[model samples]
Target chain A: MKSAQRTTRRPLALAVAALVGLPLALSACGTSTAASSSEAVTEISVMDYYNNEPDKSFIGDALTKCGTQAGVTIKRETVPGKSLISKVLQQSSSKTLPDVLMLDNPDLQQIAATGALAPLSDFKISTDNFAEGVLSAGTYKDKVYGLAPTVNTIALFYNKDILDKAGVTPPTTWDELKAAAAKLTAGEQYGLAFNANPTYEGTWQFLPVMWSNGGDEKKIDTKETEQALQLWTDLVKSGSVSSSALNWTQADVKDQFMAGKAAMMVNGPWQIPALDKQPTLQYGVVKIPVREAGQTSVAPLGGEVWTVPQTGNKARQAKAAEVIACLNSDENQMSMAKVRNTIPSKTTLAEKFAAENPKLATFTELIKTARARTGELGADWPAQATKIYTAIQTALTGNASPADALKQAQGQ
Target chain B: MSLTTDLSQTAAPSSGKASRKHGRPAGPPTEAQAPRRRTRQRRERIFQWLFLVPAVVYMALFFGYPVVKNVVMSFQDYTTATFFTGEAPWVGLANYVTVLSSSLFSTSLLNTALFTIGSILGQFVIGLALAIFFQRKFPLNGILRSLLLLPWLLPLIVSSAVWRWILDKDSGALNRFLGDLGVINTGVPWLTSTSLALIAVVGVNIWIGIPFNLTILYGGLQEIPDELYEAGSLDGATGWKAFRHITWPMLRPVVSVVLVLGVVYTLKVLDIILGLTNGGPANSTQTIATQSYDLSFHEFKFGEGAALGNVLVIISLVFAVLYLRASRRAVDE
Candidate 1:
């Protein structure tokens, strides 16, 4: 009787154990199958955040073209812009990072510092002829880990009809900008619009103003930065710019411009295709204003760079590097630059690209003198960027004066 | 008569003692029969436990694992690099200390309190009023009651997007309506100004929470028997008097449940605020949940984020305990 009881209990226990173990074992096998199936070098996966139209198609075309050159079929994946870094980190931890990964310029340093990306030199890829700012953006500790074919920066985009009616010629100096914005303010419309929300986009929009005035991110609590902050505050206080600028994104700013609610906006060239879609909207682009007449405008560089992540597969990494090289080739660079309304990263191609696309001349000119955000601080740029936007929010919302806001944001 | 006699016999203490005295006399059987009977009872108990095994395993895998992992992570120096290096050295309570001492901690705590309290009060009062109103017979009452749940049916992100457009200063419907009514020449900066952002956010949250509160409270109101109100009304209790004596005391359990759940849900609200203002206009709307998300996803400080998340969980746990106690007392009464 005792042995029979034991036999019944043992089988029941075994059944319960098998019930739990089956699913776990199946999942483990599933992951192993996916890992082992990629042994052949016929195909490599690429991931990026170009999930929007025109960019989605444009990037697709470039990847397909590059895949042909590298003799490998490409499997592409795209995630939303904001979740890309988190997804990359997850993939890194799982040891399943994509062969070719696209990272936004400012994020490259942080991701590269993780030791998950192979330096371009490892694959014998040359970094020559790339623009200095983008080169520095993709570099980590003196080694280039990524390359960008085309780059972009923000400029002053104005409504031609509104400016023509208001007799404004797109202000080039700070005083001129203030007066023009004030003069253009009318019923149901503000004179200018720009993003000052508490995000990196807001910080990006403020960089041209700050850098043009000789403000340095390394020392954020300076008189120059204060002056820049005060300019934005004065615009809000005088009612020349909308108080809602604090909530608007760069996209929202463009919407306001297209809606005829604002005459001028500080925006980037990424909006060119959208603007062109509105046939009745006449707009012009110019460099963002400087503090004085003689000072040159210095905008921050904006773009995405392609890198070969360490996937622990030598052949796949080599193929990914070839694709990256093909994407950054001179011919592909010029073609992508024109189609994307961005300037080529190679200086030699910029003049030709600009000559072909006259509408983006202002952006091309601005790109020549653009500065990379991570140039000075590298991985520490995000902290400073946060501080800058915090100061902007504090000053614009009347929480503190510009100088005091900067001081407080610097935690002094 | 027989059923009544059986019930009385079972209820009597003498009958229970008599049964105990005769427990084995009538059931005396051979040893084989007794072992088989015991084995059969044991098998029945095992079968009952088999029904609970799936739920136990699920709880262990889902809730149990993440919570334990979070508690462990909070004590480590986890960052972006840690993903590659896998070298998250334990730092004791350093993460908690850093998060608790940060300047934003107090501000976030205050905002969380204000947001939760302001949202709960607004949601409960308005929801209760609506629930009471719907209790009255009217035309299309059922349809109207279900229609009111549309806000709850829509995704939070969608609602946030709709609210963002509605609250815009220039082209928004609210501002345009106000302007047409000659309320003010300039549009109110609903989401841009620091003074108004928290209020606007709270208002939006209240709007989102009303349907949930209304549904639960309405169900609770329905469970109260009509005879109770009829009885109360017979004793000069009508309208306010009836509600004061009958509805209030009977609805206590449901009210406690709703309030505690509301507090827990409101405490971790991130999507609406993030979609609308992103804790902007100088951090006027920054709550602990949003701050934790920022620390983890945005700043890649997973350890600090876990620490902040644990703090929020502790707060929720306190409210949960109070709820359990209140519910138990209600049951006892």
Candidate 2:
């Protein structure tokens, strides 16, 4: 009986070992070797979060072209946008960071603060000719750590057919926007749609409204910010904008506009491809309205900046920096901006881009005056972003007045 | 007897050869046999423990290590910079204080309790009714029972995505169906309203959990002897009376098992709520699990996130201990 039980138990123990040991053994096999000065570098790895179509292929082709120019093969990895930062931190601790890394503009300062990226000046890369906001977004502590080839910002998108039927041109100021939105409201259709969900996207959408009104992220509980919050509250309260906007994402707002449920939407130029697909939908772009007629509209900048991560491989890092510079060349930037519907980071290229692509002219104009979200707060931007979105949600849900909501969030 | 002889031989091959050469008899024990027998038993005990080594090591590597690491992380000032600099100063309960004292903590804790209790109650009552109905004689009962398992089989993320469209305010199927019936004029903000989001999330969880509860309860129902029901009928205990007296008493063990497992599973439900409302419209559906994820991933406050995660684990541990006690008592009865 003992011998028989031993035979049966031996297999069970072996099965358990195989089940647990296989993953451990496979994970242990991932040891990587960085190129030493003694050996010539041959391949460089790149990582980004453009895991979706069109942009994925577009970025892939650019990387391939640049890799050829830099005399190295590129091994690129794409992850979901939401998981990119965590993945970077994981790779950083493991000493397996990719050679070239792409980060969203606002996230640059946080990662750079970790000392995981090499400054572009280390390679003597020229940073001149880039727009002020573009350059500021890539700089951490007066050192440029990354550079974006193209940049974009949010603008107002209106359905031409619906607006024409309503006999209303696009509004240029806050009061006019409110009046137009109210007049355009009708059965089963909201006049305007934008995101106010309790997330960073909500904060991004609210930035233009706040900043254009001279509200500062540093001091959010002020009359300037409260007036901006009041405008958002008024839109939802007057039945012109849907209260569901508190839960809608930018993508959802775009869907509402395309379906004719919303006559106007606050969106970005990246949504142009989807809007262009509907031939029946004649949409026109304009700058987001300012508080008063003469005030300059200040939208938040949006784009990804490419950097060379500190991988302890000087040879490979140099090659990676060259690839980044190639990606940001004037010729590559212009062609990329045209294909991706973004404005070039360099002001000179942006003028040619706007003239060539009339559809993105408003976005190009908005990018010139756009403010980087992290320009003032640096790595501390996320905490302020959370407070802003919380205030927006509270005011929109009728839980508190705009002034009290800001006060409550600020007090926390 | 031969088994003992075989064990002794394997334990001491040199002594076995000497005895075999001398052609010693097996059964009658001399003075030397006592010591040899003791050594053989010791060897057997060692062999038995050797079989458990693999399982113990596996548990330590996978389960024990992570739990210890999480507890350690909760007390340190780990952040994005810690990944590179490897410098996490000992903050000592600061994370716990911040996480527990924050305004959202009370809301999330209450939401977690409401979500768990609401999901389990709805799932159990409806599931028990369906199981008892299916227990009766009916045609196509086997196929119908298998068909009910569809909701339990699909991935939670996929189900939540489909349900999001169905619960949408303006264009959802539920609103359209209700409008046709003149139930209401405007669409109900099922997932958007602060007052209703938690209920909507609980309702979805209950839908997903029903199949699991039904399958387990049905098996428990099958284990019960039919003679009890027959005897109860002769005693004039039929239908509801029969269930109350016979089925209910027999099914207690299964009920406790199902309820404990359901509570543990429902406490960590993050994907469904995240996919639907994302703790939005004023954070009406933010459970502890989702809040922990938001802290770690969204806010990048790893230390506070770990503290919140440990709090959840403590809650689950309490339920686990209760389950073990209940199961032990059930065995005794």
Candidate 3:
């Protein structure tokens, strides 16, 4: 009996040792790794490029819905959009990538070239179902590599109550915009929220107003760019807008708007939820005012695409694409639209949303003329954008003129 | 006979002749001394090999291999397409020439030098003052010393974050408090202005550096003999004169050590920059450390980034060599 007891204890001791040492040895292999587990499971990694925590839970819910529909248990992973491209590059070199990927509009090129993403052209749904510009965005060269999951457009958000009180119509031209902005300029309230600082809040901002008037950085000497810049600088010079808040963010503009301090703000429909929560202010959104008489009311598009890494098996890639399709189905799109506060991508479902949701219908109408910035070709674009915005910032601060600023950007 | 036998066994005729150039007597025949010496020699050899293995292995896998690979990569024209999947196109010395001639690279070098000089000098002066202050017997010296250490002890991310809040123009507590005291009429754009952003970040870095410098220098000052000061005073010296002749000479070795460390630490600075403006406000504050990150992570130009990194390593190495030479000279004198 004593001999038997000794025999049993040796194996148990060795098993305990193995348990203690295994995980440490494994973690040392890499910073992160996929550990295949028994029991039915599918792993999917999504990019929450903005690192928005609320959206993480939204992805979790959407995947759960899709998993139920597909009869598979899906595991989810998320990476911030900024460094996610680098991480993908590191993994792609070794031919290992997550089963599913979420491609931000900017990162589509990097991953498509990495040879790690499987093409989504073979998926069950026809690619034509999505909006033209967004569908084009998810395609790299001639190949469609991702699905247009969510579509959005830019517009001018105005406080309805303030507009009525001031007895001013929403501006449709440069002159009218300046005049209306002057009329609304009273007390602490700004005539229009035009503080473009850093990159995202600024880059395409004053540029769009200029572009509408036939201005462009490429066409440096155009009157449109100068006129648009003048409109903004004039607002600052007139004291209708404060240069002190020149480096402010969209959040800052939203803050001033919510308090009924700013009558007009150029923003996308993504901000509708925050604006809707204001108890005192009544608001309406419209096509962004144009610089030229016949020019379309132009706004920038903000959207996302679902991509599959090439490392994933083709069948699995097809299944993931199908799952993405199911998630963007009419009911699911409506579910997300309720939370996203933006227009859905699908034409048929979009009609359903417009029929039922009044605000969404108004947003869809504006989408007819909205545009996306030049599709990013170089990875340097993000950095280039920040630099260009700073140039504009320099011009705004009286350190440089619009011509000087544009010249500096051209040199870079 | 035993000594001669051991010497005969171990030393080649050339080594024995080589040993004579330093002017040591060449007779060998001490039997009792031979084994104890041999055992000690054996122990030292084993220890030398043991100590060398970890360092060699680390250098081979991480440092040596990466550098060799990087130099090879510098000859290639790498884009996203050619970087990971296909054979890279060789570009010879074109990358090196491009980097050397580029205005951005030159600007980055200037920024790095300015940062290094400012950080080192500021930390050294402040640290010395704190060391002297702490040396004096004062009430709550222990508590005050602990409080001084807070800046160095706090995680860099947290420290930069706190500084960001304090330096904020409109809503910062600093501007509000200073204005209340009539220091200024309005808040300064401490971060947004390109001219001021570099200074602001350097100030924060200097603040973080103070406690570390104080701690080490104070410990060093305590090791200095009290009698040396008395001896100097008896010879009729006081104040700055006394400090210059007696204190500074005594503190030279320690000061040299601190400056060497300061220079090396400043060269690798990245976390503080990342947490602040990410080397922005028009790249005015972009240092060698930040440019490395931008080139490698942001642009995927790893070869150029590695070369830039090697430049920093070389700068630190030169400073270290100078410090070592100074220490040896102090010892000999």
Shift in Å, residue A44, candidate 3? 5.6
lDDT of 1 at B220: 95
lDDT of each model, Cα atoms only? 0.89, 0.89, 0.69
True contacts kept of 2: 0.46
Ranking by DockQ: 2, 1, 3
Model 2: per-residue lDDT, tens digit, B181-289?
9998999988888898899999999999999999999999999999999999999999999999999999999999999999999999999998888887787899999
User: TM-score of model 1 relative to the true fold?
Assistant: 0.90
User: Per-candidate TM vs. native?
Assistant: 0.90, 0.92, 0.80
Summing lDDT over every window of 10 consecutive residues in candidate 1 chain A, give the lowest-scoring window. A26-35
**lDDT per residue, candidate 3, B52-167, as tens digits?**
56655555555555555666667777656553465577887777776666566887898889888898889999999989889999899999999999998899999987886687
Ranking by lDDT: 2, 1, 3
Top lDDT model: 2
Candidate 2 chain B worst ten-residue window by lDDT: B1-10
List, residue by residue over A229-259, the lDDT tens digit for candidate 2. 9999999999889887877889999999999
Per-residue error for A230 in candidate 3, Å, reads 4.7
Candidate 1: residue B290 lDDT (0-100): 94
lDDT at residue B211 of model 1 (Cα atoms): 95
